[model samples]
Every structure is written in structure tokens, then in C-alpha cells.
Target chain A: MHISYNQKEVLKGINLSVEKGEVVSFIGPSGTGKTTLLKCINYLEKPQQGEIQIGDLHLNYQSLSKQDILKLRRKTAMVFQMFNIFKHKTVIQNVMDAQIAVQKKSKNEAYAMSLKQLENVGLKDKINEYPSRLSGGQLQRVGIARGLALEPELILFDEPTSALDPELVEEVLKVIEDVAKSGMTTLLVTHEMDFAKRISDKVVFMENGHIVEVGTPEQIFEKSVNVRTRQFLKKIYAEQDQQKLNIKGG
Target chain B: MTLETGMQELLMEFLKTLPINIIIIILSAALGLLFAVLLTFVRLKRIPVISQLADLYVSFARSVPGLILLFIAYFGIPKVLPLIGLGTYDISPMHAAIISMGFYHSGYISEVFRPAYLAVEKSQHEAADSLGYTPMQKFFRIILPQMVPVALPGYGNALVYLIHDTSLIFAIGIVDIMGTAELSIARSYGTNQILIYFIIALMFSAMCFTTDGLVRKLEKRVAIR
Candidate 1:
């Protein structure tokens, strides 16, 4: 598949697939089209040329009708970097909206399902509160709950922890780790190299709109053959070491 | 008549016309809000011809003076109706006032609403889409509620202006408060003109103040926090 914005290619001839129950993470530098690739999977940003197959649903961006696109989207849920809960809705309503609107569930059933999902994310006490009242960690947990409520075939996380404070990152990552352990198919675009190493079964390295390397986390982190992949990993590790040093010296 | 009786008679006349003024203000404001929503939707969707027409209507309504628009509605619409093969029809002054004020204020209301709708972050829409929400579902559930708090301040202002504009109905000879005041002044040979005008001013101010307080309370209730 290929994608472009304003005639500049953003994703070029990319071919990748995820097996059921596998956790895959894409890690790359900023402006490397990691988020764009995730968005294209659910047709949020239409690729100029691509065919996406998620389970039984197949969509060609060039020819798919509106209904087909909606069908494709139903198979996947996304957790945004900014934790974009509907501002006017309470936390439980955020989780319940899609179940009632898209899945056509009865209100009682949706309420029950949403409560369970919210409790799973450890937000049972915050159900009636609006997003503005929640902290960054709590908001992201609500976002995860909203994604999980649909019971989609795949869940996409787009840099979910990047917007959180350093102390709040662990709470969100722990929820994601639990989701990974549950054997759900997952695709993530993340900058948290250590978390990615721990949770992802497969890690993909992308640069300049191309997938530069794909392997097990150890293989990509410790034994990368490509010069660009090796350099990127080395730079990320050096920055982490510097931060640790600053903390120790302070 | 003596000064005391004259004052009493003027007060009675003002009270008689108050209900008509209130009715016109409420009806025009409701109609204006409906039209504003339609205009904002069209402009947001960027539907080619209809969007351009909405833009034209807003610009035309905003640029023309309110009294001129009232005259056009009262005198001009009857002439245009016949050309459309609908036979001549008399547009009552009350209907003319409502229609003209509704369309005129809708232009201002659309200006208020469009920006409020756009002010909602793009990520909200993307999240809704990724969740598989249909467009209608996204709008009502996600978009419209957020827009209300943002749009309320401007909507309140528009309502106040509508209240002031209702006095213009006297141009078409409707016996609203301003018209009734004019009639009372004429009957008194301009002896109580200053008092009548002063009372009308006070009534308008009171209505505006009441609207402002109500809107502020509503804003506090619906505030995002």
C-alpha cells in the first residue's frame, strides 16, 4: 500500500500483516509516518493506493463505498495519543456511545458492558465523572475502556503514553500490558522503547515512509542488521542513559 | 388629563403592548436559531451551490439595515410571490416582522455557531470515526453538545439584539410596545412623550439584564469542567 499528502509520499509500498492474538508495535522517529500508517489501517486517513484486510473484511481505498469503509472500521478500535474522550460525556457514556450507536445494543446492555470495561481498566469509581475531572492517566484509561467496549477484532494504540507526564505513563502502559496479555490482536505506534520491548511480540522499524526492519524485539533492539535501525536504537538508548544520569546527579 | 392620570394611562398602554413584544421576540429568536443551524451546517459541509447561497444570504442579511429588510418583507415579498405563479398574498405586519427579524438575526447566529463548532478539536472527530460511529451519530452525540457551551455567549447576544429589533415592527405599523408608546404620545399631543420613551428604554434594559443572567447560569451548568 502507498499513501501521500499533498503529492508527497507518506507510506510507500508497505506490506505487513498481524496474526490473530499477536501484539505488534511500530517504533520510529518523529515525522516517520507511524501514526499515518495506523490511521490508514482503519481508513481514517484514506491511502491513495492500498488494500487493507482485517480478518474477513477487505477494503481497497480506491473503490470502497461508505458502507464498506464503516464495515472495515467496525473491526478495529483506536486509542488516540491525546485521549480524545467526548468532552460533554461522562466517562461511562464515552465507553457506551459506540455500543449503542453503531452496534445497536439496548441501553441496558450497553450500560452493563461499559461498566465492566471501565472496571477492567480500574475506573469503576470515575464512571459518572466527565473527562475534564480526570487526570491524564485516568483519561487514557477511559480511552482504553472505550476501545475495549466494542470487542473489536483488533485494537490500535497511537502513541498513547506520549501525552502523559512521566509519572503517569506507567498506569496507562500497565493497562496496555494487560490488554496484550489477554491474547487480543493489537497494533501500536509508540515511542516507549522499553515498554514496546516488553509487550510486543513483533517490532517494526520504519523511516521515511518505509519499513526498514521487522523482527522479534531482541532481534530489532540488539541484533539489527540495517545501519539506520541500529543508529536509531543507539540514539534512543543514549538519551535514556542521559536522563537517568541527570536524575542521579540531581 | 392631570399628570397622575396621564402617567397611569401610559403605564396601562405599555402593559397592553408588552405581550405582543414578548411573543414576537420569542418566535423570531426560535426561528432564527433553526435557520442558523441550517446555515452553519451547509457552510461546514461545503456543499457547492448551497454553501455559496448560504454565504450570500448571510452577507446580504448582515449588510442590509434591519428596517429595510422589514420593508422588503412587508412590501416586496407580495410582489415576488405573484411572479413565482403563487397568486398575490398579503403579508401581515406581524408575519413580516417575524420573518425579517428571524432571517436577519440568523445571519449573526450562524456566525456565532460556525466558529464554536469548528473550535472542537479534530481529534474528537477522528476518535468517533475510528469507533465506527456514523456521521449523524458523531454529530449529535459528540459534536453538538460540545458546541452549546461555546456558542451560548453569542446566542445570548443575538437574543438581546432581537429584543431591540422587535421595536422596528412599528415601521410596518404593528402595535408592539414602541408602536403603542407612539400612539399614546400622539393621543397626548406629545405632552407625555419623554415619559413614554423613558419607560420603553427601562423595559428593554430589564429584559436584556434578565437574559444575561439566565445565560450566565446556563453557561455555568454546561461548562466542560
Candidate 2:
């Protein structure tokens, strides 16, 4: 798989194969093309070149029609960083829409499945409420629940906690941690370095549209061979450490 | 004027042509829907030079007075189709009124819908895409359902105008409730313009008010969240 913007490449000639229950975390600073890679997998941005395969289905950028692409998408759900639930719809309707409208599931079955997904995300109580009525963290949890109800084999998370308040980030992260444990192949694009260190089975570091470094948390954090990865880890952890020191010192 | 006699006479006269009025409004609205759908497809396709011309068509229809459209359709169309069916010279103004009202309001309704279709949030499209809905399903389900609530006010306004414009049916010679009232007043007093105008205005105002009232109720009921 590959993603290119202009002449610069992001995830150039990426040949990683993810098994079921494997979790891949992409860690990079802004403009590293991590989000673009995630969008390409979901068929949101049709890559100008490259092939992406999910299980038996071969997804070429050109060969897939709208029907084929939508069918592929139903199997792979992306949890947005912004928690992009339909604000006009209630939490229940947002979850149930894919089931009834796309899956052609019965209303009763869809409702039950939605409720179960909401319960799993610890959001069963807020099913009738609007997205605006929920906290940012709660909204993100509902977003996960909405994705879960789609029954995707591969779930994608686009920095679920990036937009949350510092205190609320933990709640959304915890829900994601639960989803990861459910044995679905999940690709997460995240800025939370510590969270990625703790949760992801494998982490890939990218810069300037290239996979600069990739390894286990220990390899990435403690034993990264690439100079860019080392510099990025230092810069990110240095800024975060300074913030914590300021709070503690004050 | 005794209450019972005057009211009964008025009711009898009004009831006599209410069916024709009902037919006119329903037919015009149906025609309006047909026009809106055709125009929407034309706009969506962006068909070469014809697509650019949709704007001109919408603008021209909207700018021309509905009364003049009625006059033109009743007078002009007959000339165009002189041999319409077995030398029948007396084509009903009812048909001309339907065509005119449908043409005039289609301009406004299409504009209502064009923006309504666009105003759907970006995330909604992404949501449909992620869920595996084809373009057709996305347009019909995700997009159009949301569009109804957005277009409600404009649609309601158009329907109300349809009622009011039924008054212009008199110019084309349709026997609408308004036309019947005007004819009654004219025959009674050899052109009592004041009474004729008052009766026609009051009758249509009442119909338009009730129709608008219903539209408001529907708007509230179907409002998104």
C-alpha cells in the first residue's frame, strides 16, 4: 500500500500485513501523512496509485466501483478523532443507521445491536441523547460504539483523544483499549505517545511521508535505530515533560 | 342579508366549484414536483450548455408574473397546438392554470431544494460512504431525507402561493371558487368591482391561511431533532 500527496510520498511502498487481533499504531508529528494513510484504507481518499487488500478482497484504486467500495467499507470502520456523529440524530439513530440503511437489518435487530454496542462502550444510558448533550469524551465513546455496531473486522481510530480535554482523554482511551482487546485488527493514528507505547502491539513512526521507524514500544521508545525517530521522541516527550513539570513545580 | 340564507347561498356557490379548485391545486403541485425533479436531474448532470441554461430558465420563470404566464399559456399554447384533438378550440383554462403555476413556482422550489441538498453536513456524506451506501442510496436515503426538513419552509410557502394563485384562474377562464364568486358578483351588479374583489380576496385568503396553517404543523412535526 502507498499514499502520495503531490510529489512527496507518505507510506511509500508500505507492505505491512496485519493479522486478525493485531493492532497497528502510527505515530508521527503533524503532516506526516498518517491520517492520509488511514483515509486511503477506508476508501475515503482514493489513492492515485497502489493496491489495498482486506482479507480476500483486493482493493485497487481504480478497479473498485462505488458499490464495491461501500461493501468494503462496511467491513472496516474508522473512529474519527473529532467524534463525527450525526449531531441531528440521537445517539441510538446514529448507531442504528448503518445497520438498518446499509446492512438491511431489521429495526428491532438493529436497535438491539446498537444498545449492546453502546453498553459495551459504557454509553447505554445516553442512547436517547443528542451528541451535543454528551461530553466530548462521551461523544467519542459513542463514536466507537457506532463503529462497533457496524461489525467491522478491521476498525480504524484517528486519534480518538486528540480533541478531548486532558482530563477527558483517559475515558475515550479506555474505551479504545477495550475495543483493541476485543480481537479486531485495528489501525490507530494517534498523537498520544504514552498511550501508543502502552496499547499498540506494533507502532510505526513516519515523517515526511515515509516510514522512518517501526518496532515494539521498547524498540521505538528505548532502542530506535533511526535518528529521526529518536529526535521525534525526544521533542515530543520533552514538550510533554515540560508541561508536567510546570504543573508539578507550580 | 339573513345569516342562514346568505351563508347557505355562499356555501352552495363555493361548494359547486370546490372540486375543480381541489383538482387545480393538486394537479399543479404534482406538476411542480415533476418540474422540480427534472430540473434537479438537469442541474446534477451539468449537461454541457443546457446546464448553464437552467439558471436562466429558473431566473426567467421566477421573474415573470404568474398572471402573465397564465395569459400566455391560455392564449399562446392554443396557437401552437391548433390541431390538439379533433378541432376542439375551447381548451380549459384549468390546464393552462396548472401549467403556469407549476412553471412559476418550480423556479423557487428548485432553488429551495438545490441549497437544501448542499446544506447537508460533510460528515453525513462520509457517514454514508463508510456505511457502504452506493451513490444512489446515499442520495435517496441519507441526503434526501435530511433535505425534506430543510426544504419544508420553501415547500410550504409554495403551496400557500398555489392557493393564492388560484385566484388568477379567473383570467384564464377556470371555474375555481374565486372565479365563481367573481362571476356571481359580476352577474348580480353588472361589474361590481369592489364586491367582486372583496369576495375573491376573502375566499382565497381563508384557503391560503388554512393551507399555510397545515404546512406549519407538518414543518414542526418533521423538523430534524
Q: Score the docking of each candidate (DockQ).
A: 0.84, 0.44
**Native contacts present in candidate 2, fraction:** 0.49
Error of 1 at B100 (Å): 0.8
The TM-score that candidate 2 achieves is 0.88
| Tens-digit lDDT track of model 2 for A153-172 | 78989878889999999988
- The model with the greatest TM-score is 1
Residue-level error in angstroms, candidate 1, position A167:
0.9
Q: After superposition, how far is residue A140 of candidate 2 from its true place, in Å?
A: 1.9
TM-score of 1: 0.95
Which model scores highest in lDDT?
1
For model 2, the docking class works out as acceptable
Off by over 4 Å in 1: A1-8
TM-score (chain A only) of candidate 2: 0.94
CA shift of B54, model 1, Å: 1.2
